[model samples]
Target: MTAKVAGIPMILCALGVFVGGTIWTIVYSFTNSKLLPKTQWVGFEQYERLWGENRWLTSIENLAIYGACSLILSFVIGFVLAALMDQKIRFENTFRTVMLYPFALSFIVTGLVWQWILNPEFGVQSIVRALGWTGFTFDPLYNADIVIYGILIAGLWQGTGFIMVLMLAGLRGIDQEIWKASRVDGIPMWKTYLFIVIPMMRPVFITTLVIIASGIVRVFDLVVAQTSGGPGIASEVPAKYVYDKMFLSQNLGQGFAASTMMLITVAIVIIPWAYLEFGGKKRG
Candidate 1:
């Protein structure tokens, strides 16, 4: 009873700050609120305006491209590195530290670093050209069609290390007896990993997916620092759009509506996971 009483403040804060604020944002999204949140309700007008914008649609496409590539490549790269590290090879600690070092830096730093690296005149392209290939062209940041992929490279560099560490921990948790059984049965290493090990790591993968999905949904700082959604708004994302609307354009209603849409996207990802994670167990 005392513990429950002690948690009351936290519960109230969650309700007021999170739940209440979400409700307020959703309600205000329906209003034609400009500099201030006016009481003039405008129904779905803001949403209609939002969906009508080409910039918003482009942002969604960029996000989808980045999200899909990041999700697949990061998981693949991380898991492969973890598998290699699990071999208990020489200087494992040094290799692990080198891989994880980038994750210690903030997204802003990662973006700036990669931005310099991807610069056409002074970066990889220039270096390769200097090395005798006068016709080398490799500038993803400047190209409107491939700018998101450049940012994606930076993101994977920063995030793959963390995912590798998580996967390594999951791999370490598997029983040694399982390995012995596989070995005794003369099962190939690849088959063991693909069939038995991956299935056992379901919870780890789910947690990693949620973390990556949330990051993908709220990606702003990285894009801002990297390209500022540029090469002519080619790499714009939903969060940056909402921020520009609210703070830059001073269009409160539109920002609120965009944010509400973001919330709905998050719910779409989380609700199904939550049901399978908790509800299924309860029913069983």
Candidate 2:
């Protein structure tokens, strides 16, 4: 009772900030507000423009590509690293620290680091050319065709380590008795992991998926620092579009509409899964 009493302020703040702020954003999203808040209502006019914009379309396509690739690669790379670390290899602590160091940096820093690394003149391309290969070309940020992948590279480098840590924790939580039983049953190590351990780590994997999915949906900082939605808006994501519209372009209505769409998209993806995750557990 005392704990609940002490939580009153926090509860009020959540209601005032998150719920209230969300309602305000959604309300204004339907208005013809620009630069400053106006009483004029737009009635989905901003949404029409949002859907018709080529740049917004590009952003969605790029987001889809980034999200899919990031999910697959993050899981695979993180699990592989975790599995290797689980072997109790030599210099385990040192290797883990080295791998996780990137995750400590902010997305902005990661983007800038990758920006320099992907620079055609002074980065990987230049180094390879300097090594007697005069015709080397590998600059994803400069090429509109694969700029999103460039940002994805930075995203993966910065994020995969954290995923590895989470997976490692999950792996460490497995019962040693399971390993003993598998060994007695003459089960192959790979088969045991694939069929037994992974299945048992379902909760951890679901949590990791949620984290990765949310990050993919709201990806903005890396794109800003690395490519700034270029070369030619090739790396734009939904969050960036919302920010540009609201702050840069002073199109508050449009920005609000975009943000609302993002919210809906997230809810669409999350609500059903969450119902199954928590609701089914409660029922059982």
Candidate 3:
């Protein structure tokens, strides 16, 4: 009872800061708020303008591509690495450490490191050109057509290691009896992993999906640090758009509108999942 009483203030403060602030933003999004938030209501003008903007559209498209590719690739890479690690090979700890090292770095650091490595003048391109292949052009950051893919590479490098760790944990949690039973039944390793193991690990897969999906939506720092949404706004994400609109562009209404859309989009994804995962189970 005493601990519960002590926690009341903290809970109230969190509700005020997060829930209250979200309500404020949603209310202000309906107004024509500019540099300062005002009560001058403007209905859906901001949202209309947001959908009509090319940069926002580009950001949405880029996000879709990045999210899909990242989701598939990260799971594939992470699962593959985890499976290999599960083989009880020599130096397993050392290999696991090396695999997870990239995840230890912040997005900012990962972005900057990849930026330099991908730079045309002094990075991979130059090194390859110096090796008697001057015609080789691999500068994705400079190419607006493929800039998002470049960012995708950096994101995967920084993130897959963490996914691998999570997958390794999930793999470790599986009952050894299951593996032994499958082996005794003469079930091939791949078939057992595909048909039995994966089905059993649904909860872990869902958790990983949530984490990666959330990261995909909120990706901003890496973009800022790497390309600053540059190469002609090709790599601009929704989060970057929100920040630039609110602070840099001094259009609070526009930012709020974008943020509200993001919130709605997330809710659209999450609410259904929540219902299926929790609500349906409760009913069951």
Candidate 4:
């Protein structure tokens, strides 16, 4: 009883902070606030402005493309890497370390490096031109329609490493007897993995998907560092839009409204996913 009483203060303190911050944001979202709070309430005006903004809409579209591509690419690449590593391949430790090392670096640094590499004049395109492929061009980073794919490529480079590690850990926990039995039954290796191992790894995959989705929702640094939503705001995302309005534009009300919209959007998407995942687990 003494220990429980001691813990109560800490729990209460955390709850207080969380509730306070949420209320502050909610209040700000409904006001005509600026750099500093003025407490002038203008309910739904900010939200209406945000909904009517073209840039905000563009940001949402870009985020959809970015999130979908990144998630799919990361999962496919990570699963393949995990499967190959599980085969007792040579220098497995070295391969694993090499695959995961990119995640250790900052997204700012990663984006800068990729920006340099994707530059058409002096990067991969130049190198390819030097190799007698004069007509070759690798300028996806500059193309409005394809710039998001460039960001996705860089993001996947880091994110796939995390998924690889998770999948590898899941693979390692599988019983060796299953593999032996599959071998004894002369089951093709691909069929064994597809029909047997992949199903067993579903929980790990779902968890990884959740983590990736959350990362996508909060993605700002990489977009800012890489493209700065440039090439005509083709790569704008919600987090970047919120930051620009809050800090750069000093439109606090609009910023808060955008943030609130983002929070709602995330909740809408994640609530169903969370229910399906956790609810299924409970039933199981």
Whole-model Cα lDDT of every candidate shown, in order: 0.95, 0.93, 0.93, 0.89
> Candidate 1, residue 96: CA error in Å?
1.7
Off by over 4 Å in 4: 1-13, 273-278, 281-284
Question: Which lDDT tens digits does candidate 1 get at residues 1-284?
Answer: 99999999999999999999999999999999998999899999999999999999999999899999999998999999999999999999999999999999999999999999999889999999999999999999999988999999999999999999999999999999999999999999999999999999998998899889999999998899999999899999999999999999999999999999999999988998898788988999
Write candidate 4's Cα lDDT for 64-173 as tens digits: 99888888888899999998898899999999999999999999998998899999889999999999999998898899989888998889987798899999999998
Instruction: Give RMSD to native, each candidate.
Output: 1.1, 1.1, 1.3, 2.1
C-alpha TM-scores of all predictions: 0.97, 0.97, 0.96, 0.92
Q: Encode model 3's per-residue lDDT on 235-267: one tens digit a residue.
A: 999999999999999999999999998888777
Tens digits of per-residue lDDT, candidate 2, 92-205, equal: 999999999999999999999999999998999999999999988999998999888899999999999999999999999999999999999999999999999999999899
Model 3 ranges with Cα > 4 A deviation: none
lDDT of 4: 0.89
Error of 4 at 264 (Å): 2.1
Worst 10 residues of 4 by lDDT: 261-270
Query: Distance from true position, residue 5, model 1, in Å?
Result: 3.1
lDDT winner between candidates 1 and 2:
1
